[model samples]
Target: MTAPVTASRGRVPASATAGRGPLGGASLPTWLAAAAAGMCAAAGWLRVLPGTRMALLLALAATAPLLLAAASRLLRRTASTRDTRPDGGPRPPTAPPPAPAPVSRSVPASTPVLMPVPLTLGLSLAVAAPVAAAGFWGSPARFAQAAAAAVDGWAHLLATTVPAGPAPLLATGPFLLVWVAAAITGELLARTTRAAWAVVTPAAVVFAASCALAGGTAYAVTAAAAFTLGGVLLLRARARDLRGPVPVATRPARVARVARAGAAAVAALAVAAVVVPHLPARPRVDPRDHVTVPDTPLTGVNPLDRVSPWLSTPDTELFRVTGDGPLPQRLALVALDAYDGRTWTSTARYRPAGSGVPHAPSGGRRLTVEVTVAGLGGVALPAVERPVRLDGPATLAVDPDTGLLLDTGGLAPGLRYTMTSLLPAPPQPADVDAAPRDPAPATALPPGVPAEIDALARTAIGGETRPGAQARLLAAHLWARVRNDPGSAPGHGYGRLAAVAATGVGGAEQIAALYAVAARGLGLPVRLIVGFTVPEGANGLVRSGDVAVWPQVRLGGLGWVSFGPTAQAAPGWQAAPAPTAAPLPSTPPRVVPGAGVPTPGDRLASDGPLPVRRPDWPLIALIAAAVLATAWLSPRVGRAVRRRRRRSRPVPADRIAAAFQEVVDTAARAGSPVAASATVRQALDRVDTAIDRRRPPDNDFAPRQADLHVLRELTERAVYGARPLTTAEADDAWARADRLRRRLRRPAPLRRRRP
Candidate 1:
């Protein structure tokens, strides 16, 4: 009936299977997609500048599978491909295949799945790990540390800033992620059918991760163009293969279909281009923020509590500073910012200090000082603020938020280190009106703060609205009115602070604490610092005599600026700042000798509090959503596999039987299940009645009554008739069953009736 099928009717053979290996062959389109995916994933290394040698190694990792697949295809030719006549041109035609023998059972054994390299695929991926590891390490000799390097890379990436290093350990994370994804995608391309669609998934995951960690914004356009080209090529190739031989008469229709698909894809990309650029930019949610490190060495220890003890033992040398230039004016041991009615503690969050030294605000002179511990029994190290670098004898941890340093391994006696610090420029006379309040509510007193202290703070600040001016007025008022008696007992608690505020007489520790609490009342955020002030013409030695506590008020732009409340001649609103400021105010020139210049504002707005950072909660939510989606879709995946197995049977009798089973299953899922024990005719009757009851007469539910009846008759003949099922009858049955599956999958469930 159909004109004898041949290669010459402007029609190609469905498959030149004789030329393909038994396992299958990778389509040219799949190869392009896998390679493109590998290249995109490899680009992720740009974030941390993984070196040149690593790039060559990664290229090898990406290409190895392609090379191996090509070799396998070349070496293992099918026997049919070699068969030819003595003329050396072509093989002669053979007789048609004989009809299949009649089958007693309704179904035969299932055919093999489209992909056939389970064992080989595992071996391929196993080989991929070390290859990727070698690529990351950049040397064959260093493979031993590959696994450890992968783990270390996570910490290294999070601890160090962008463009961290070309270090081997740091390159492992991106290498393993890209290489493993590429290897898996390669396997899918090498031996599969429509499964080629899955080739993009693994590579896409790696590509997305790379995009997330990329250092610059240039990834979007270039990567999109590359991926789009590969994806289009793959779609075009697979569509051609799925269509098998194209008949001349159907060529125009096929072109129309392809044009529609291409148009749809282009439209989707156009809509995305139009929409994405206009969307609001969201903060990058780095899992790095959630990485946990060792707690600070002085976690709960309040350095302010040590103030009275140090002053009591005035001559005890805690540490010594020697330098290449002029010595530092003072060294701050600790800044205690959090007070919860009782104890004041530093917000010390220590992580391994990799490269970034946190923040160093403008206006500072660089100075290098070497500090060597002497009798500094406490864990806190005496160091300058805004340290740029440290080269030391101890393992150090630094708080990226506070620029606070800690010796994780313990600050033993005689421990030595050199530090680079930014010493702030002197305060200007006009600074009083320039600075604004940056009150950290966390530092202010809670509901438990006494009323009289709050009232005194208001009185001290008076009519001064400017933050810097209010701070100066408050400090001057304390120095003039409060009497510092060294004999005053050592508590700086709420009761002790209130006692000192009322009596106007207390040790320096109590006065400093009172200053902190009172400053909070004037709407100025404050913290207490315990440190030694270097005296004029001082030698290298720093003693407990210099251990005085002072209050620092945080201003909007200038950060924590220290005021000298203990200086005896600190006149009200007259003495503006520390000793290094311009010409002195109207007050007497009795400024404390060798008082430090204003400490540089190290805590930038970003470094102030974790709340200021947009929390990466959406990442956690995405993880949860992925888990739920996986659980929900798992059964669907299993059903798809089963459906493929049922639909792909090669034997005519088996195909007919599987077709009937599929129709019954589809009916069951659609809420009109037929009884398992029912006869073939009975099952068809029930299915027919259910379909008629649910589907509207004019609607698009496929397999009209006549087609379903014909499928039922064919199924009956395969299962119960004497003759073997024919290929024509089997095709008709499967076509109708698939149409039914489509019709049933839509539409919400109705009143479910049990079988």
Candidate 2:
């Protein structure tokens, strides 16, 4: 009773008769999948973007895919409409047949129209740019910088710790990541039937990346739910689109769809309940932790150098502290952990910090102190031994292991910040075995340390097997042996420390540095802490006179415990009185030869003075300069070598391409950078644009434009042409490229200036 249906190729077919659903328009589930990808990333970025901002951004991100999909659909329809002819061009019309012989005819499937890549990407940029500007820059003036950040902010984020604040620079990374994921996923789903295999798969990879970059907050349950819904919805939508519209679907097809949906729901429930929770058993290693911040010139003016100046300018107010809950008697600026026998420096790994610091292993009494800088300047923000939280306007960076805070925006006068820190308990006799030995700069013995210094350190510890007792005995020994001369010459080099150990006469600067070196020699982890001491009977005004350089030993369960070398100051030098309101329990001013603390009875022998070896000044200076020069030129040298190899490549075609790359690289170094992925012709065009922007009209300085044209043609031929290149042709290409490079390297003729 049914007429036979046949498929053929001729007249334009209707939507119901064509297989255009899957390859043409995006179904509802595809849209959901694209949207869910963005939400997954956004959910992870909750800490970076607050409630209202995050909601607004999410709305924009979700809407962008829809807008993009609509544009794509419209573009495809417009393109299809423009093609008026059939596959064989315009054909003559034929008369219809009788109704009794009613036959259904199907046309051969036509290739689905696709939105041009340029248009699709252009639309995506148009949609994402405004959101990036509004969300990250928030100001027209900063839009350009924000754009640059969008390109590379993710890299910067990798170097910073978690919750690295809501700064525009860091937030741009997450914003761009989510936006790009949505755009790509939307485009794929809209154009292809690979919903589960292709579209959702890419989104899942990006989701993993989002989770990695996101701060340490648990959103697994919510993200899992979104993934479940999105995956199921996307798959079902793709299946329906492949089968065409639901209302027209056959009874069997409808049953299949319902059955598939039910199965997917059940699977999702099972996985969500049983699988997601147990994934990734091992602790996740943060990518940010692997990133190291390069050393800057800040090391030159570190707090160690300020010791002498602060001591000399005794009465100058450094900062004033006002707080409750037993404020620390001492405040440290930085922990000096790296010693190179010449001088001690902190291997300060500064990264953008948030309000809360990750907790340290040891526990202590928590106290909150607020500080107002009077004359204290530079990057150091003095805080308690182990700061747990920082609340202030100043941008901060912290060393999580040491709990040392650094002010990225240099500390200036009147800068105020509140730091809540845990005051480590005073050194106890049982600490010898409790403290874990650090396997790094903390207890590392730097190269070139004089042998006598280690022997001297061993002498100070004196067969005390227990590390805590040994540390106490050593500190007490240093106090008894060394006289705290405030006017003593300042330096913590091996020579200075060795002399201090031998002569038994040193000020706080030498003693603290010497103690650190000695402890490292004894294999005990330590830090040379530089800060001001708060003395009793004095108000909160901490002066430069209170500058104390002391050593802190890491005990087993107690964090860094301050082991001061008790007072042995000269008669004339006395510590200023501090407020007795909230005395720091048990600990006292002992490192600076402060006049309050009692000296220990332990004293080590200094029977024979160790000879001080003067470092070779000129030789050392030359070596340092050479090392610096080498560091600067290494990259350039490596580039030259690479270019040489490229020019000498075995294949002539490769040589031609390499020649072009060398020129691009040189141009980029000169600040006119072209992307590595750009085609040769495109790169050359951009280079031309850069020159045109800068070149003056009627300027007599002529450039070889003809050479550039020939180079571009040769490069395009080498990369895309069918013909293989000859060695002679490759040589000639390199010759022209070298000329262009030299021309670029030469400073352009100075534009004649009129007085």
Candidate 3:
């Protein structure tokens, strides 16, 4: 006969177990982890500076869910305790009485996973929506605006290119999604022992790699370290929550063991991260010229057409020239004879400038400009207006109508050519008027000519009939009406000039185009030429900033004469660059410029061919020495780390298990290869097997065998049996395990697997 059971010595009431959910009481860690993930993701918003307001908003968005979870946890804990006592006071202890009969109370099983899936998803969506809305809608107040307009605005936000402005505000949506997904996945995986890697591994790799690729080196290293620390904390917390049902008396050892293992793994990963940057790069053939030169089509849209886009890169080396005589301030890429008010194109049929040398006035000096295509490439070679010679390995044709050079096959990087042009000699005023009348094609105006442009031209010229004087008057008008701004380049020359006339501001290119259009309106054969300008005093290095566009007028005797509409230089003969640096070496190696961003070295290394780089033997030797040293010390360092981390556990039994497990893992990493699923007995057997295979001396192995047996028995009892291990017993076990590990280390070389 059994007495009625009492709660004191029996199974706990059902209420104690009712709190279980799919996350299994792991809400605290889950929310914290989610917040951490969100913040890390937000750090990649854009390369630009995000102000203090944006940073605060990002922090609040990430932390809101965590704070809610914490508040809810506190409320539930308070509610649970409310039923235990009247004023939440602890129950008073009384004198011990005879123990009651043991009895069991039925507890309802935990809620099924099916319900929590939607709950978790709902919670995650609830958290993500506000963040997404903030990112898509920009400001919270904008929702009150027209619904249709708001929807269109949101669509536009999504379509915005990467690295767009408003920074963290634009990035919050993606960050929230990644965080919720990773945290939820981690929570689910946490239910199983050793399964946290399923979440941590992919997250770590993705975030770390993204930081490394998109951010600078310092940012990447910091991100990697932060990720490691966060992941370890999240994993440890989730693991602790899972062990909630285990007996408190025996839980410490297990927790400590897992904690030590996690620490060691993270330590090894962090060390590897630091070492990787120092490793010698693999040898490969160097990449040479692979320039993507923007083509100027037959329509004759000048380089000004690309100012809005192409001008972003100010350092790109376009070309390098070596000349027998003075180099011109500008080189014409192509000329347009037809203008439609907004743009220009050449409708005139291309004719050979000459079967041999093009005719130039008798008094001009013959000079040659040898150009190397350091970075430029296109169908047309940028040259002076009248090129009499095209000397290179390419077949080129000249458009006598416009004096534009065209290639049969497109030009490429490394292309070398020499252009011999008879430098322009100012003609006598009578000779210009006596020469053949300016061609009608050059002076023709587009349809619907703006009245204001014609009126302005007439007002500036003030009844001047001479073509040269008209050009000069128009140049003076352009310089006064339009201001030169190096920062802005207009896409449409004529439109830009019209705007400048009204707005009183324009870039050099726009001002030049204004003069061309106004001059043409007044019946002068004027056109726009786009090319580089050597500074008033230059050292032969032509930067992208040197590119300029200005007007040129065709006179009766003089070919196109540069009209200084923008005050780029004095109007005579477009003076040559003053000599500074010596000519480049005869033989230069092929230069591989930094991708997209041009460096100073993009300039020609030589006047001849590219130069070859010599290898650095000293750096190579230093790296090799470091590698050997790392290899020699690795095992010793690993052992010391393991020992220190193992002893970090406060519980005696836990310390013993941690020390033994460290050996098992180290042996596995060092090629013993024990599966996580292996039982204590099975793992010991593997250790014995590895020891036997490596060192097979029967008499000398007795002490190590004894230690191994003691460690195996003690660990099995500590982990699988109900008996609690005493402190003395735990210490003895640790000593034996440590001895066995030392013996394992002393044996023949262990092949370490790559991390």
Tell me, by TM-score, which candidate is best: 2
**Candidate 3 lDDT tens digits, 1-755:** 11110111123322233235333345456446645754665454333224455455555544554454444445544555443457767778758744322111221233222335467557755655555555546654443332333234333323322123443333444445344545444444423333555646545543653453244445555666666666767676655443333433324545665676666566666555655555443322211112222223463334556543334566677777677656655566766556777876555333222222222222345667777776655566677545555555424555534546665466677777777765444443344334343564577776766666777788878977877667666666655555556555465545565667777566666666677788888778766666665443454555565666656666653455555556343212232221211111111122222211110101110011111234455665665576567656755665576577566656666666665676676577546865432445556777787766665567757877778777777665655456677788777887777666665665574552221
* Model 2: lDDT to the true structure: 0.62
- Which regions of candidate 3 deviate over 4 angstroms? 1-38, 65-119, 134-162, 167-193, 201-222, 225-621, 624-755
Give the distance in Å from residue 691's predicted Cα in candidate 3 to where it truly belongs. 8.2
RMSD of 3: 20.5
Q: Which of 1 and 3 is the better model by lDDT?
A: 1
Per residue, candidate 1 scores C-alpha lDDT tens digits across 460-548 of: 77887887777776776777677777668877678887888888888777777788888886778888777666654556788766676
TM-score of 1: 0.53
Model 2 lDDT tens row, 1-755: 11111101121212333224433445665566557655655565664444566557755765576567756665665665454466857655657733222111222234345658668766776667766777767764556776788767776666555555666776775666666667777777666553456766655765677566553424555665676566656666665554333322123434654775476556546544543343333334566667765423234387888877777777788888888765567777877877777777887666666665653323456788899988888887787766666777736677766667767778789988887775544433443334454344478776777766777777877777766666766776776667777788888888888888888777777887888888877878777777777755556788877777777766553445566564524345563322111112335533444444443211110111112345556655655575567556655765665676677777887777777767776777666775422445556666565445444354423545776777877776765567888999899889888877775565544561110
Alpha carbon lDDT at 247, candidate 3: 38
Ranking under TM-score, best-scoring first? 2, 1, 3
How does residue 82 of candidate 2 score in lDDT? Answer: 52
For every model shown, what is its TM-score relative to the native structure?
Answer: 0.53, 0.58, 0.41
How many residue pairs clash in model 3? Answer: 7
Q: Which parts of model 1 have CA positions greater than 4 angstroms off?
A: 1-33, 45-118, 128-174, 192-197, 210-283, 288-301, 305-335, 340-342, 356-395, 412-452, 463-491, 499-512, 521-755
